[model samples]
Target: MKRLLTILLLTLCVNLSAQTLRKYSNEFMNIGVDAAALGMSNAVTAFSSDVNSGYWNPAGLVNMEDKQLALMHASYFANIANYDYAAFAMPLDHDSAIGISLIRFAVDDILNTTELIDSEGNINYDRISKFSTADYGVTFSYSRRLPIDGFNYGVNAKVIRRVIGKFANSWGFGLDAGVQFESKNNWKFGLMARDITTTFNAWSIDKEEFAKVQDAVEGQNQELPETTELTIPKLQFGIAKKFIYRHDFSILTEVDLNIRFEQNNDLISTSVASINPAFGFEVGYIDMVYLRGGVGNFQNELQIDNSEKIGFQPSIGIGFKYNCIQVDYAFTDIGDQSVALYSNVFSLKIDFDCFR
Candidate 1:
């Protein structure tokens, strides 16, 4: 029974990974909720210092000295899907902070179809059904600055839930840890371990629900099966340097490396293992307005013309800050123009202490 369960879990993980455009299970956890991070191609492991750090690198939360609230929303594939996030952070002391965050991704109003024929030999459209699919997560985080200056560490505990209409559902749990280091010269380094303990999702299916649909169809040969999925751990490393001039203008450049332990056939030929790299740049003017851009997800692909091409995704974004409120926008190109290929994200952040 143990071996059978393991095989079933692996199979489920592979299917979910394929459907979610990720190399591992629980791909929704990999989505960046901060517009600032997405606009910078998710190279903010060392640069996230706001409330959204709860989702990026919890260690960055130690940099927050004021209570903050942040909210973000994104439309994927031209509104075919939606992603939303919210976070709140508060300092427990001079060197410690706590945070809570929520993330949700959903695809709604999907039409369910059947192939039952009427007496006139025509397909019946009378009994159409609709359903939605959604993924949700809640995270609790804590960060503390070490007694040694310029160093910080943090951890996040999360609960995840997913539902496909009412036919199937899952419950998952995971842990993440991160560390950040800054140098006197302003260079920064960061490391994050996502799903450090291997996230597990136990799924239960309503066979009766699927059975009804199968009965509606003329010829069905498959039955619904319940299973579990496991998301393996991944490590991210980042380094960044900032150039400041005239005390009014600054440019920050960062790079990140993503290491995955799962076997990826697409990247096998390129190296013995899969290692994805990302790069980002941000230009700030007096801390009021900012411009950002980045590229990531390097892959080798074959073109329709029988040519080899290296594929990468690019993103751009802008941000504005006034008083204690900040607004950000980002546009990402996911390489598919035909089917919801572009993603637009917007975020707002407020610092309550700034008013005082």
Candidate 2:
């Protein structure tokens, strides 16, 4: 019986790794909500104070000031909508905080058209098909603060899915680990290691692309394999500082680091195992509103001459709070397109702080 149990456990572990291999690239879902609000600083895992943090940094959950539940939704300009971010914290008997969260991203209504071709010049039109990419994902998180000092820890497991036209569909899983620390009087810091395990499972794939097996790896295309395993890299980190002014105004600046062992087909694969860093600043005023802007070096390092400027991701955002509900929004530029395709984010939050 002991041997049987051990074998089963080993099989489960192998299966998990196999799942990651099936997907081409664990294309993370981050459509509707502004990546800036939480991702401006190299994926914003430290935006831990509100519901958005549940998506960006689940480890922040341990720092919740009160036991509460929150729900938030946001939309982006490219017909993308996200339904996420819910967390309920319950202070355990020993001052330890326990919390759970749900996060998701979705995009839809894309257009696709195909041109018919005469396959053999027989005047017979060839079959044509078309479609757009659609994707969604969900993740669950648990977090808690450590006692005896100012430290925290948390974990999250995510399930992702995506489909495009009639060609492909895939699903995958991801895992995250994070920690946070603060001082008695002045300093605060956070770090989150994301996608410790990331994978994508091939759904329906583009038959056309798959059919022509490339001759050389230099071609930069897919090659048939006995099995395809998606590449999920390691390590993403964040750090921050707070500046106080009087009692109502303050400035918080943050810098984050992200490194990845990218897949062969990933957008960032060319710079595999490279560290991409970012910075953000939040200025608070009137206690009811906030002004924010940020930039990342990766953006500038990746600037394309004709695509867009990459010097920075300058972002502007605002937040409003009244009694028990708070709302936040931000606008960002992806260095793509000169005028039309700039990205934006909208967020709505409800808190029961009145009762905390």
Candidate 3:
């Protein structure tokens, strides 16, 4: 049964790779950064206004009061994969800001077993080796406020890199655009168009390294995989409002609609597109301590009894700000309602004003 399963999985992977345009290409970038935003289920599109705004909605960078630096790390898939991120942002004059960010997701020490059995049909443990698979993204972002008060726009130029040990690698490029508007009543609205130019990755494979696998599994992987990959566009729209009372306490609430052109298992699915809605809120005291909670990833999942049920992911987090430094932590998949494993995320942010 184990061998049969392995063969079936290999076939499915090969068939899926035949398509040049993938629905989830470069998906590691979508995992998000900053524990505060992840805890809010990535619903901060409207009010993401720090160094991390370079990844969430660049337009929000204009709200920064000083130069800032951000860093975050998270573990996934039972610690098999490590995700790391860092960013820096500074105001360019009064009306504009610029930032750069880097992200890496990697799985290290993956076993290579194609040569486990030698040509003499002898089992040789020494022939086994280990390699790693990693993906990287670098983004340059610029944001400027418009002549009209409370309006801003931003753009991002992104470069993507992927590596599969010595077997294959690829480079990709893409563009993104974002806009934010604030109303007189303090209502915030934002729109983000990701991969506006459609990202493309061209791979180069090592035929010699791949040849060993072709003969290891007869009739399987006989041909090389596709060399090109395309990532489609996605849109996120958000709105937020903050309610303040008693001078020192406030609550900020936000809602976001994430749209994809292809139909899938999202909550609002159709032939042409699908919409996933996320809702989050933060309670703050004296602008120093905060508590956040959110729910998202709504899906209609198939059950064992041939039935369907609604499943979602929930996250909660806390944050503290002191002088020019901030620290945050989040606990995701609180109830384990979804199929994905739970994760604990942590992040730190510092403002340059402290140095001066």
Candidate 4:
């Protein structure tokens, strides 16, 4: 039965990959939720050791020494959207941990307009409306240290929901798995498989209401259809090393490689160009003040026009920790030359065990 389940999971992933093609579904899942992780260009697969580890690599949850609660918020695309996350984690036993997290991404106060016009050719301002679009996800994660000295394994189950005003909505389910290994020399290696079960979203549309609006508007032929969308699986591998100097200062560096399998004319390409790589470095002083920087999303061709091209996205962040409370901030470049296009993330965490 175990082998049969594995086969079914692989088949589902392949089918989802074929259906998604070049498009990404449930893309909000890709957004980094932790300010500290974002500051490191999301290269924390092997460097996870905090509350947010549940989102990066569930196996890393085992590294926490006590119960933790964390909260984060970010503004994206010039304040057009807001993203927020919250999580709590606790050790279940000597060798195992459990965590739960919630994520919300939303765009509010959007102007909704229909073409219900008067016979006098004047636009009816009263017919205009306002609505909001939002996406939400909740994840439950569990991790355990394996019998092997420095090995750990973890899994995450997630439920997702998306709403577009009152016109359409979708619900989805997905699973993720991860493993981590630590060497005696303090080197860490991590592997994560996201959407291993082929995340599936079933969308329901209000076609009757949509049809009424279409009829009110002249020359409108758009129709709504109920459909299901899939989010393909993605794999990530990472390595990290840390250096401690005289117990007063420490430096850590990590690199992560991400792989996405997409079908091109029914062929899968595992070439170098298809792999996305991210790099990060962190410096800590007296375990209080921290500085971080990294680069990622190396796009070969990000064209503003026919001649203008941009390269990879870069990020920097700072952190401070005092007692059981920690605060982190990160700034990410979103590829636009305009300053308004940048994103900012802020996070706070508290550990209850500090007082124990």
Considering every candidate listed, which one attains the maximal TM-score? 3
Q: Against the unseen true structure, what C-alpha lDDT does each candidate score?
A: 0.81, 0.54, 0.88, 0.80
Cα RMSD, model 3: 2.5
Model 4 stretches astray by more than 4 angstroms: 1-22, 115-126, 212-220, 263-273, 302-310, 334-340
Please write out the lDDT profile of model 3 over residues 72-184, one tens digit for every residue: 99999899899999999999988999999999999888777777888789988898888777999999999999999999999999999988767678898999999999999
How do the candidates rank by lDDT, highest first?
A: 3, 1, 4, 2
Q: Could you give candidate 4's per-residue lDDT for residues 97-167 as a string of tens digits? A: 99999999998886555434556778887976776779999999999999999999989999999887665
TM-score of each: 0.87, 0.68, 0.94, 0.86
Better of 2 and 3 by lDDT: 3
Error of 4 at 24 (Å): 0.6
Give per-residue lDDT, candidate 3, residue 258.
97
- Which ten residues in a row are the worst by lDDT in model 4? 264-273
- Name the TM-score of candidate 1: 0.87
Candidate 1 per-residue lDDT, tens place, 1-356, comes to 22422333343334443222234667877878878888999999987887988888999998987999999999876697899999999999989999999999998886655333444668767755677778899999999999998999999999999887666788989999999999998899999999988887777776766554555544543545436667778888999999997999999999998888755523333344577889999999999999999998776677799886777788999999998998999999856512238888999999988767
Residue 337's lDDT within candidate 3 is: 85
Q: Which residue pairs does candidate 4 place in steric collision?
A: none
Cα-based RMSD of candidate 4 = 8.5
Native-vs-model 3 lDDT? 0.88
Which stretches in model 3 have alpha-carbon errors above 4 Å?
1-16
Error of 3 at 45 (Å): 0.6
Error of 2 at 258 (Å): 2.1
